[model samples]
Target: MISYRWLLFIVLFVGIFATNYLAMTVKEPLAASAAFTLMVLSVYGLEKFYNRGPEKVTDERTDLINMKAFYYGSLALIVTLMFEFIWLVSEDYETAVLMAKYLLMPFGAMIAVVVLSKAYLERVM
Candidate 1:
């Protein structure tokens, strides 16, 4: 059986992927927003469940891994935004906005995966 951490990651991955796919296919702002919200809530719930209690605190290594994940994810998001900007200039603003909106969930999911993987590796090996 997969560990709880890996199961959580898989759930997050699927949620983000589904959200992005829905956003792309539905082409409705409200629908996209709802999907995004669901993804965010799922992530928050996972974090809460994994952490177990309000009084528990994060360690330095966890903080560092999270920071590194954010750094890398931000870098990737920036590049994607730049590409979207180029697309906007060349194609149309609406298209670029749609692409960017669709990207947000996956980018967030990527960050979660990276941080969790780092933490899991630290714990196991």
Candidate 2:
């Protein structure tokens, strides 16, 4: 049977290709490609970390760490959203519409915070 890791890798590869292709069609292809390369490397490193050991069952400590990480992540998301709201409020309609493309930034920040906090908590506690 196919593994989840392979599936994730395949999806990421497809996304990378699609992103680069679209980026090449845009004006700043070089900058986009550089950013994409960095993102790919980061994902590859994370994949290596995940596959470094056999999967383990979650325990009580793990649960506690995740809960706290989630709390911190949610707080970050709230703060990010507040900033986004202020930016939107201060902009004209056209500018606001343009900035709306970054609506996912807060979600991305939340995910990053959650992942980083969970890793730190695991090491500390």
Q: Whose TM-score is greatest here? A: 1
The ten-residue window of minimal lDDT in model 1 covers 82-91
lDDT of each: 0.63, 0.60
Cα lDDT tens digits for candidate 1, 1-125: 67778877887787656655554554444454555566657766877777785664778766765565666566667645643444353445477778778877987887687768777867764
Candidate 2: deviation at residue 99, Å?
6.3
Which runs in model 1 stand beyond 4 Å of their true positions?
53-125
lDDT of 2 by residue, 10-94 (tens): 7578656644444434434444445455555666686676688876698888787878556755766654554444344333445
